[model samples]
Target: MTTASTERTARTFETIGVIGLGTMGAGIAEVFARNGFTVVGVELTEEAVERGREHLAHSTGRAVSRGKMSEEQQAEILGRIGFATDLSALADADFVVEAVVESLEVKKDLFRRLDDIVRPDAILATNTSSLPVTEIATANTRPGRVVGVHFFNPAPVQNLVEIVRTVVAEPAVLADVEGLLGRVGKNPVVCGDKAGFIANTLLFGYLNHAVSMYEGRYATREDIDAAMRFGCGYPMGPLALLDLIGLDTAYEILETMYRQGRDRLHAPAPILKQMVTAGLLGRKSGRGFYTYERADSPVVVADDRTPSTDDLPELRHDIRTVGVVGTGTMAAGIVEVFAKSGYDVLYVGRSQDKVEGVRAAIARNFDKQIQRGRATEEQKTEVLGRLSGTMSLDDLARVEIVVEAIAEDLAIKTTLFENLDEICKPGTILATTTSSLPIISLATVTSRPQDVIGMHFFNPAPIMKLVEVVSTVATDDAVAETVRALCAKVGKVAVSCGDRAGFIVNALLFPYLNDAVKMLEAHYATADDIDTAMKQGCALPMGPFELLDVVGNDVSLAIQRELYLEFREPGFAPAPLLEHLVTAGYLGRKTQRGFRDYSAR
Candidate 1:
């Protein structure tokens, strides 16, 4: 959004040359010509040139059909483009941009040719997603004039363009490119020559981590995608996005990044290689992670793989009355969940003050929903009427299902389970909403170990749509099934898993967040840029630092620490900066500080 600084240029780029006539290249050429610049599109052959011409026609025709453009405008845009079948056609171009295959050798060969063929003073740019810009720049004779203009897919649509600068790039050349991109209605972010520049560097690490989770069979693809789409507000699940991106493309991106960074997080999962080898290239190949109706079709159909389903327990006790312990946000959210679902909910607290606190939390939750026109006064009254406060464990004896939403410590939860074991009726399902910690250890406290299970809910349970139903080795299938079914009754997507550290989301999420902290600690990029990269570059809900602040830095550090202890993998070690921040009591929004300042709020 800043004005481009003045820079020396041989002359303003009056005519543009675009190499390659693929989807990206064609769209980019269309963008230049649509803006009234004469563009020469070069492909290797006449057939490829015709295909490129048709691509432009199809795109502009669709825009006209959709009422986004007039027929005359589309015709004028087509008239501005002149197609050729050789690189020499660009000899007169003032600026030439290469949007060819991602192979380094291919790009190097093309750039070397472009350097010799195009006007010596013409600026050269590469639309590479992850290759080092310096390497590409060095292939040209005038390296000072080379830069990276990384554009997102559908160049005619996405506004972002990463303006990459190499050490040899002259300040004047950089400014000229910046001002040109700005004139084209682009939001350019400047960054140094790096493996992924600013965007892909932060994005691919997170995407690759999700692939690793899938490789480990930790969660079903559906649930993994659902957890993020529902839990984090991501536009799509990781696996689904991988399919849309093409597994082969993703494999190549990860391979390049891993070779350059050597960070474990960038390591491509073995499964990705296998699938790519099988020709499951993704939407282009008709299949990858999920089967689509046809090649390039968006409609997805159920494949041979069976979605994991839990059968409701036939002989389980009916959970007509429920008991929820704790007075924090999670506890109150659980209380609201049960109350709104027409169950008699008994919330237990230590003192009258604690009981009042829980009630206030629930009231505040409903008040906001009501203010937003999402809840009616009668509905709020009905929900509140089902909730009853209790100061004694004796009152919980009548409830059939007792779910404890206390702090994450095992000692506190085990103690609560021990008390509940003696108070609740026999065969009562004891569930813990623990993100981490062994459910079996909590279950072993009671004689009925088979009855205890983990029902991990994302924060703000009333709004978030995911609930992980975790089963310890000792837990009965009926207990897990009952909990999973209850999640459905309360309108949540319940994902079943084994009792493991981090369950599903946290196991996959925290490590990626930890890596982001490492990047920030290493001064790879600023927090705002990293966040923007993930949100705009990867279409994520929030950047890692923003999520860390909301999730609490202490909580994230603690989770990563637990993961390290359980796995003993060097990669799981909490980043030193994150550890020091937690140790300094900068626990995030609750404390008004962490990676960002929330003090003003």
Candidate 2:
């Protein structure tokens, strides 16, 4: 191994060299130049060099147009970067980052050539997202000075940058690179050299699973995309994101990760290879999972796969009164939703006190809404007037629908369904708000299985707008339509899917969270570092660990276990570390501890 000096002093980097002038490379060069460093951008051919130059100008010009940077400043920034068609121009570069293609051999060849051109003290880095940095580093004589600086796309805007350190990397070299990234306004997350590192490893697995869902016709693409956006507050859906990232690029990354880790979850879905082969390469090609308006267009145009309103099942318009069971937060919110939407809501609890608690909860929520100018005193009174509380299931006999938001325990919920079946009228729609339990299992316990459906709602339902309308095999077409229409009437976005372990959101969510746990358990990276990688690197609303802590470790483990049982995929199994956390009674915020400590708060 080529070792660098073990000195602890910080190194000053003035000249930065970037090889390849593709989109990523150009963005990286702009980042360095904007940070006031002299940038030497090298490309193989003059045509490629001009493309890189135009990319920089267009990006900086947009900043000027947006008033983010003055034209004079943009010119100054452009002036700081100098382009060259030869590696000899980088002889004096203090730091060099290779942002070429994903091919290992090509990167190794570039590094070997750089060994003869650049100074021995200059730090070398690869911007490879999936290829092993260590193997690429080994091609050079000074392997100890080589590192991986994986920047997110649109590097000028994205804040997170992963600093991958191999076992042979010198400590000083790593520190200097991290310091340089920090100086350039990037959040640097350091981790051991591993394929996919942090973000892509967790992200692609979830994306691939979504592809598998789409391939199986588990749900319509629009519903699948809307579920994640509305249910989890994700900025974009998996399929849409896959389109933004070229399908071919995503496939190659998954393949590389799978080859290195041998983890089945990282294996690319078969459809991904097929899609790439068909030239359906997402936005660039105008088609992938969704058809774009044209090549390189962000606007999507309707195709044959788009659902038509003319074919929708007829909705039952007779749902005037709704019944909600349980006194929990979800039950109270559901009752509030129904009441506020002009439906008479009858809520049942274990006793009169618990039943009254539901009413009080709704009253408090309405008061807050009124305070926020979202409702009026008369509106609150009118909504409260529409709500009725009772301790007897027999009172639901006159209701048009009954939504069970009780405990997630299978036996407890099944027994409730059996009782609701006996008490409710013949045409009453019975819905369960179970997030993970099989809706079919609950349906089978009732005589009116055709009336049974899953109406899974996110927590704090009064604020959240998503309600997953899951239909079992036995669910009548009209019943699903009626519930879906009811959701629209109540101002909720309902995404339909077949009854399964997790429906859509949880099915796609928890596995990624479990993967984060596995990543932590393996000592690959710290929880905070992993969280930062996701939140900043991938533009996620929250990191997997932060979400897991908020969701409760026990709840997450239960959902993960259900997924494992239903799919029988080894990758679906709950991570042992998560199980241990749950076993220790570190449930979540309620218990004051989980993946993180809440007691301090």
Q: Which candidate is the best by lDDT?
A: 2
Clashing residue pairs, candidate 1? none
On the 0 to 100 scale, the lDDT of residue 110 in model 1 is: 85
What Cα-based lDDT does every candidate model obtain? 0.86, 0.93
Let me know the TM-score candidate 2 reaches against the reference structure: 0.97
Q: Give the Cα error of residue 108 in candidate 2, in Å.
A: 0.2
Query: Superposing all C-alpha atoms, what RMSD in Å does each candidate have to the true structure?
Result: 3.3, 2.8
lDDT of 1 by residue, 211-297 (tens): 777778777888788877877788988888889999998988888888988977778888999999999988988998899999999
Q: Which stretches of candidate 1 lie over 4 Å from their true place?
A: 1-11, 308-315, 598-601
**Candidate 2 pairs with clashing backbones:** none
lDDT of 2 by residue, 1-601 (tens): 8899866778999999999889999999999999999999999999999999999999999999999999999999999999999999999999999999888999999999999999989999999999999999999999999999999989999999999999999988999999999999999999888899999999999999999999999998999999999999999999999999999999999999999999998889999999999999999999999999899999998899998878654467498899999899999989988888999999899988898888888888878888999889999889889988888899999999999999989999989998998998898999999998888998998888999999998999988989999999999988999989889888999999998888999999999999999999999999999999999988899998889989889889889999999999998889999999999999888899998888988
